[model samples]
Target chain A: MGTVSTVLSPPALRTGMALAGAGFRRWATYRQAMLAGAFTNTVFGFLRTSVMLAVAAGAGGVAAGYRGPQLATYVWVGQGLLAVVQLWGWTELSDRVRTGDVQSDLLRPVHPVLSYLAADLGRAAFALCSRFVLPMVVGLIAFDLYLPHRPATYPLFLLSMLFATVVSFGVRYLVNLTAFWLLDIRGVIMAWLLCSNALTGMYFPIAFLPGWAQAVLWYATPFPSILQAPVDVVVERGTAGHQATVLAVQGCWAAVMLAAAVVVQRRAERRLVVQGG
Target chain B: MADRPTTAAAYRALLGAQLRAQTQYRFSFALDTAASALITLLDVVSVLVLFRVTPALAGFSFTDSLLIAGLANAAFQLCDMCVGNIDTMREYIRTGRFDAVLLRPLRVLPQLVFGDFSPRRIGRAAQALVVLVVALSLADVTWTPARTVLVVIAPLSGAVIFGAVFVAGSTTAFWFVESGEFANAFTYGGRDFTIYPVGIYPGWFRAVFAYSLGFAFVAYFPGLALLGRPDPLGTPGFLPWCSPLVAVLAATAAALVWRVGVRHYRSTGS
Candidate 1:
């Protein structure tokens, strides 16, 4: 029993490491997309920020607890944060599976769930450098958005954002795994995109939303924690205790989703075996 | 001479082939259509949610915004259906499929137009029509002969503008066949641009749409005419009429550029 346990532990760790390594290599080849993504985000950020400023002005200097600089900070940072969090265009795993690439993945020694997590993490890391940091820096210099000047706040904000990354990736992976059942994923993705756009505080802040709607969105989806919470931490001078609690909740959700992925994968593998795939 | 059987017959042949090809994947084709309709419906729902929270967006009333959304969706989908193959030009060239297309006896543009037809995009068209019907019932659009004329031309002119953008994007494949990213600014970005009122954007962005890209025709200026909206930026009365002209210019520019790109493509064979 002891020898069996010892052998399994090493293989699990090795599988994780291999997944991460393979993920990083694949991401490295798509450097051009990373750069182009950054540029497109920058354009969109500017356009969105302009509209937000106008809306804020029309609302008589503060709509939903945000003055000019505060609103600018929200709009600009939300763009950057969303880049890292990526609430849009995350249809990778489902597409691969639908194209029958899941068969190749099943052949791997590592678990399929770990492989997806690793690839997402690797891609998120690349996106952070190319889309988030660079664009935020440009917005900082060009638009003078209010940024985290306090040292402690930055670290906490980073932690929340990292939590956001993990949770968002988990939700996306869970959604992708559904492709095992649903052949057409476009409807599902579109629904996610619309929901995330509204709830992630991308187009408008959650604070601006009605109380009932805000309460529902906060509990139903991980959207707020993924983008708004991290940016709000920066804007509110890191009074992020509640946000931290939310992140902790997000972590729990990620665990639940990961477990779900394992169950689904096992069932799917059995089905594949029966079907002679 | 202009109504020659060859031209009309060629168009029919191309469309027929496209229809037959789309019928090949029966299940996938149905799902694609259903999925697209659901997506557009979902987006409309989001807009409806926004309207619930605020009575208006950017001073436009609920019905007004709905009208713009409906009209824009119709215009975008119609043009998208017409020139949808442009987006796949790079793939065609990269896979050496363009060679087979070139070997065909029909005019290159006609064959290209006929080669790829997405029946599923009817999903978007159907959604747009639904929105238009709903918005018409909701909004009090007192129709005049002139207003009716403007409404009909609005979508036709919008199609021209979007088709021009499609042509421009396809032409770029001759130079940067593998790099389809830059083309997004013109196609996807342009569609988003048209969905919103011109007043929502800043002067520079507006200028790019008005003067540089000439994309204002697709929805904005024509929308003002349909909605009887005042010039948000204080433009002349004739400016609204500039939509049809701008569309023609954009289409002309795209054609000229495409000719040059095709010449380069034939010479370099890349």
Candidate 2:
């Protein structure tokens, strides 16, 4: 206990780094799953890019303010980012809660949230290298995938991706926390899957929605901070200030959701009733 | 395998037990159903969003694509409701469940695919049906009696084809335990591919997903028949009416693959 360090302290940072490395190693073993996921993403990439190109053909080479290159970048890179941000079902936390394995998580010196975040970051790093690159390679041969115009946009996009990962973790942790009171979290997870895919632009750009709908999604929900904002960052969607503002919004959502998670965990601690020995 | 009546009764019994267990959490079930419906409805909205940017996709009008999308959606969801759990073959194998299943006096395919139902999928299927009904009403089809029969036959045929895809794809799990995403690329990815006119895709893509696989028969060809139009990609005149034949062939292939898979199953000796 004397050696234990608070969040961001040296020892805690070391622990987080180790956890992240472990996470990276853990997922790296799933070689076939990686190949399968990449194949699926690339297939869907062709489906999406083809349709968007058709739309471009119909609109005389520009549709919804995106040219062919922009559409290619959006569809392909966004498909890669799908696994990076993990915009769908993940139930490990809730499973731990149900099985009472979370008690072991609590007994650790490092905080559960911090550890999980670190591990997820590791997972994202692995995905960014493997799953993320595969679709880009496939898309490059087939379509005009876009690259950032300014050198500065690259680092900004990286920061946005990091923020997106944090925001996703925060939102998912809160969703998982619902298991504290619910008999089953499957509905919650399904509902999350359905809405997040739509709102986060997994199916199509939130930008392609009616302007009012886009604004509502952009401002009112943290969903876009997960996938849409990061992609927008890379595509150089607007002026530098607009990109900065998008990054800022992502940062804000990440902070807000994480704060909410901390608060919820505090509350759940009060109702701590382990289910099984 | 059990007697026909007994197998049918077993399916009913298993499905009933599953429904009871799921409905025991009434609130979650309702929430999930609504979410499921809304999720699928968003797929329709996604197409509308595409049309908002363009008047036509590869010469198919908004309503024409809608029929294609709706038909594919309805068929995929029906198959998803029935055979979707074939994606869980890895788990059944890994847990020694396949071994137990083999010992049972029940037909493997029905026990595996048809013995469970998730009510949430009903919401998705129902929403797709609504889309199909809407697309049918809105599309500029000249309603011949033959076309009318196509309306009834097409979706059922498409569903059979998709179910076959699910079975065929998941049979790979017999070799690769973690083949979920591989199977999903065809079952789910095929749904996305079929929703638009085949002309929108590139030549190689069309050759692979549409001609090589049976996805074209799911919606594009049937859609052509419904609209009384030729394929924009120059599919033959007789192709539109070939969905039934395609469905039978796909089903036959799937049955063979599943048989070989079951024969090769060496379950976890847990």
Candidate 3:
């Protein structure tokens, strides 16, 4: 709070933006990879949509508190958000940590956490335009999506999405930071990947789970905040107050995760040996 | 042709070496096995979660659906254990490792696949097998001798089908370095597609993925055969028993594709 006034000074802002742009450019160069990702997402979108819609139809046009259109929104939006949130397949930090490139990163003027977050934000931005857009259009054409009835839901959903990205990056950063201590982080990474995909609303809606389980997942675990909360916001899962509450929870997780990531990174930096000449 | 026996022996030795090396790291193998078991557990939980929302999915009840899910998953895991490393073809090509691979005496596909083979990966298939057994006991299907025979044959046929799909999908790596995600659209995507009732999908999707691509034969038809039930979508009655035939056809196509891919490899020459 004390440094808020100078936080956005031109130099700092420029550095953040430059790193973000570099991140965007680096990812954008893999155009075919992006296309393949979108294609895969769209395919899964169709499969999930069909299954969820069948559930909805089975339950007499509503399944797990979601109507047909809402289910469509959930599945398609989930497919798009899957790439933007990047539930798995990120190991850049850990790779750098392995090769001792992280020492150079620490030598830079900018904080490592902040700089990496900026780059991730840029990657998310590029994904938003590329892989994300395709699923949105495909969902619109293939299914009846629930376009947010309330005007305020739009911005709130966007905010929740941005926060989801932060929460995801924070978790990812902490997971990668394990490489400093565990040279072979494969087990840790595998555990993270399994949990994120299985529990994080990637395969199916958590709402379909039993009430106790859903409550535990939404409130106790960060997985729902990373995915389910934002989709809930878009589909207007609850009243205005409830939407606000979900967003607030997601925001809190974002901040907590970021702070935790920074602390772990600091500890890791002190212990980093940078072995080999 | 006369040297086939030696080639087979050499391949077994290579795969044995890989398995031995992997088991040397007991902790990592154990963690992977635990994670694999956990993943299978979650697969059941996800399906149960879906059932909590509705009584049935496209005319299949919870137990009925589990039969499909278990068979599909067990078969998929078996295939993954066998030829999943074929996906590393892109990296091998990019890192100029394929040049050395080409210099080898044995065939390319078998070498690439068996080179990293790990039998411990059967951990996942074992978990899926548990689910299949549970589904058998709980589900309302009347067990007959024919049904028992079908159960024994289905998962093996399904593995063959899935293995073919994997090889066919990875074949694209010969031309496109970034073909991994595209291959996943069929490989992993097919697993996700098969775990649910195929009748739930739309007609066109079922035609392309379930029938044309042979994903349905992995579990759907075999499941129907086991249950002695006809498909809700009303295909021919004998479709359920045709999975072995489909598996053969798909494997043949995959082998042909692999040959074409190996021929197309001009080598990075770096």
Candidate 4:
């Protein structure tokens, strides 16, 4: 076992790179599913854009500081980010735990959580190139989307996206760990997804929510860091300093959630040992 | 030497068995039901959030829009409860369960429908019903006996229309074993589309859903009739009353497609 640990103990960066690459390749093979996802995202993007535009029209061409073009950009970019962040329907870890396949995962030298995170990063990388770009291109053709002129916006948005991905993975990892306690984690996952989608600004801008609700979402949950911050950065909704602050908040949430996941996994591992898994 | 049960009896038997099996896991069933209800709540909240940003959408006041949304939600949930099993057709086909279904004594479609009856889904249906009731109270409709009857039957018509879409979507699984996601573009997408006033969409967009797909008859036209409001887009006077006929027609066409699909499956065995 000592020798095996030594053999498997590569630098964390190297392991993450390899896992991410594998994750990218694995999802790349599902060409049809990717195409279908892209199509659906674009269609929903159009629908959301239309609804937001109507809202703008009703508010005399601007609602909640969003013009027609800005709203379009917001909706389209939100669609692109949906696949990247992927706040729902991710049950791989729970399924493995339920089926006892996680035993093999535990045996590997790499920490299971890190490996899964790496793979998710890889999936997000692929999704950014394919799923993300597809909706953006469709939006560009179909609507006059807002484009950030500042060179800084692109790098900041990328940073925000990366942080959002980490935050999302952290939440999903913690949710999946519930499988250790519950035989069926589907209901828990579904409930988390419903709440996450609402709070993450996936359905609508979190700002549009009531002021008290917005305060609770911003201060009480890590949801906005998952989608709203990144989209805000891209749309240049605020000044550079405000964008920097959003990115920092996203980073903090990502770190906190990742730490929480590690603590939960430790507890879950102890539970598994006691339960004779 | 016992007499065979009628189709209705067979359906009830299958549904009862399914409900019994689900009820065996009472805790899990309750949890799932609550989760489904929460999802419906979030969906309605999303619509309400949009209304919060604006006083009206597409010439409809917040209350009127909520009524449309509530009706659409109730209709979609009812169809989802009945025909949502279509989502699993791909897996059945892949695992050869489709063959088992085919060999059942009952008609294949009814068997498929009954085999996947989920009592837990009523949670979302009940949530949508609350929304409908709230919308009815808020809106200034005449609430005549005939209008009330139309309102009651509207969701039933929606179920038939959406159930037909689900059937058509499931039929495609006979050819493409991984067609669930593709089918979602229609079943789920159509539901999302109808929850809002159709006038918000562009001309071509409205034309496809309203004319080609006949989605306008599902809620928008009926909503207009119930509210005693004229269609801003100038739909014919008879269009609103045509929802039931449209639903029946769509279901019939879907049944035909399903028959063809079953024949294809029998020949290919895939």
Among these predictions, the greatest DockQ belongs to: 2
Give me the candidate number with maximum TM-score.
2
Off by over 4 Å in 4: A1-10, A273-277, B1-3, B6-28, B266-270
Compose the digit string of candidate 4's lDDT tens values, residues B1-270. Answer: 244557678788888998887666556667777877788876567778898889899999987888888888889989987888777887788777788887777778767777887876777788788888998899879878878888988999988998998888887778876453677777777887888899999888778876787788778888888999988988788888788899999999999998899899943354
Q: Give fnat (model 2).
A: 0.77
CA-only RMSD, every prediction: 4.3, 2.2, 2.2, 3.2
Better of 1 and 3 by lDDT: 3
With a 3 Å backbone cut-off (N, CA, C), the pairs that clash in candidate 3 are none
The TM-score measured for candidate 1 stands at 0.83
For residues B1-270, write the lDDT of model 2, one tens digit per residue. Answer: 546887678888988888898888777777787787787887678899888889999999999999999999988888888787777776787677888778878878778765556767777778789889999999999999999999889988999999999888887878987764877888888988989999999999899999889899999999999999987677689999999999999999999998898898887675
Shares of reference contacts reproduced by the candidates, in order, are 0.12, 0.77, 0.64, 0.53
Question: Model 2: clashing residue pairs?
Answer: none
**Candidate 2: TM of chain A?**
0.95
Tens digits of lDDT, candidate 4, A1-277 = 4734643566767887999999999888878778878887887887788888999999888777777888889899998998898876798988888787778888897778788999999999999999999989999998988899899898888989999999999999998998888757756777787777778988888878778987788667899989888988888876888888888888899999988987898888876732233
Off by over 4 Å in 2: A1-5, B1-6
lDDT of 3 by residue, B39-94 (tens): 76776777887887789999998889998988898888888888888878888887
User: Which lDDT value does model 2 have at B34?
Assistant: 79
Instruction: Give the alpha carbon lDDT tens digit for every residue of A1-277 in model 1.
Output: 4633643687776776666677667766766566666666776666666656655655666656666677778877777777577677777777777777778888886667776777677666766666688778877876757756666777777777777887777667766766776655655665566667767777677777778888877777677767777777777633456646665766665666677777787886664521235
Worst 10 residues of 2 chain B by lDDT: B113-122
The DockQ values of the predictions, listed in order, are 0.28, 0.78, 0.66, 0.61
TM-score-sorted candidate list, best first: 2, 3, 4, 1
